[model samples]
Target: MPPTRRFRLIPGAVTVLGLLLALGVPAARAHGVRTEVLAGPTSVVTVTHDDGSPLADTPFTVLAPEGAGPFLTGRTDAHGRVAFQPDRPGAWKVRVAGADGHGAVVTVAVDSAALAAPATGATVATHHAHEHDHAHDEAHVHADAHAHDHAHDHDHAHTRDRWSGAIAGLLLLLLVLGVGGVLLRRRRG
Candidate 1:
């Protein structure tokens, strides 16, 4: 042979490569909470762990626009979701806390338009409760209206309207997850 050559791996170079790989990998996210406003006065709340997995059985409280105490209290289901309807229209606050002191608060506003609008082709039940300033007596009005859009179709639209909120919330959650995944992939590359 006219010439001989030898090559050796450098420890520093290997270490640098390992560090790069580690930095490129996505780290687990911290525990967080997310909320979405569904149709009408309904809202969906979700709690997740660091890895984006659902945190079930978490307790949550909802405060009305004007109240000294919580208006509604419940725990998240298996999918880390809890649906609640605000008693009155205005700004509603939802607070959730984990056992480890991890918690979040979400605020949502409800408008009169949403409350006044009735779902199409659905039975309507309206209840109004008013407290008189001068008297202790309270006025209550309960109106139940059942209307059929089409006689041939017996399908109920109220059921579908109720689920629409849930479906919307789920879609929002999926969208957020998808965007987060894309960002992580981009960073890795």
Candidate 2:
């Protein structure tokens, strides 16, 4: 046999490694998000590629402010544009698709007030409401859009959120088992 093994890993290093692994796993799966608001009779939300190019022909859908919706399905054009026409004069449910390597779904406002007012004037420009306006369209959201792309629109964030949580839990279990194995080895030694 070669020289007796003298490998040592400080407890602090192990702790740090565990923490880093726990944190890194989530961030790695975290998806990019973007929303664009076109102010008009029908406010179109264009979900772009990460490269700022269009997301062409991606299947998408939209709903009205109320929970009642046989959803209006759409597909992104060559320009990555999904034009949604609000069924009624109120806050509309704008759900876009994510996780197909695209991005997250989002809710946006569409009505006489939101559309008639140019997106450049009083509020849309100042508040960036169109870009980051969750508060604007939350209260009027429909319950049916829960399984779609628009992040704030749905109760279920995505299928990935649930699976991610399960994987993290399993990782914790494995880490515990690993630590137990180490302890058993040390005791035997």
Candidate 3:
């Protein structure tokens, strides 16, 4: 090709290269959805894939017996477990799902006895009933605090993911447009 024609190809080539790089960026994803609920004073739900691998960082919601809305929501831990203390005794629903569309909705039965039971130190305090009760109460408070922290962390992560995706898309669009503008100016001149 002539010198002028060859120069115009450089802008086009750069745009193609930018597009390839942008397309190669990996996106955040949640990709599994099976659940097992171990109910007691505090219900621990374990989410995994059909192949039995844990679905780490996946989102989940705990619905009350009335089902007005989600009583609690958070992402699973590295082991794919999320625990919640049900306030009232009844049937509570736990929904574990991912963006990839695999998830399970489990109904956990909680009785008044479970709610009345102490949360921890059951084996250590066989003789001191009062100490056991106090220990349980303390453990319950700790679990609530931890759950609240998890919820906050999930919110932060969600906001960060949204902003990152938007920025990536905007940068890609600007890159394409800037390259196109350069080629157009060269052709006109």
Q: Which stretches of candidate 1 lie over 4 Å from their true place?
A: 1-25, 30-32, 117-189
Worst 10 residues of 2 by lDDT: 121-130
Instruction: Give the lDDT of residue 160 in candidate 3.
Output: 53
Better of 2 and 3 by lDDT: 3
Which sections of candidate 3 miss by over 4 Å? 1-33, 121-189
**Model 3: lDDT of residue 69:** 79
Ranking by lDDT: 3, 2, 1
The superposed Cα distance between candidate 2 and the true structure at residue 181, in angstroms, equals 24
Each model's backbone clash number:
0, 7, 0
lDDT of 1: 0.51
**TM-score-sorted candidate list, best first:** 1, 3, 2
Among residues 3 or more apart in sequence or in different chains, the pairs in candidate 3 whose N, CA or C atoms overlap within 3 Å are none
Per-candidate alpha-carbon RMSD to the true structure:
16.7, 11.7, 16.0
Candidate 2 lDDT, tens digit per residue, 107-176? 6655567556543321221112224343333222233454134443321332344346657886798799
lDDT of model 2, residue 60: 77
1-189 per-residue lDDT for model 1 (tens digits) = 223221234466567755753443223133233333332444555455433455678888888788899888988777565566655678777787888887667665666764454421111111111221331101111112321222112122322322454457656976999899999999999
Considering only N, C-alpha and C atoms within 3 Å, which residue pairs clash in candidate 2?
55-80, 57-76, 96-149, 105-149, 105-150, 105-151, 106-150
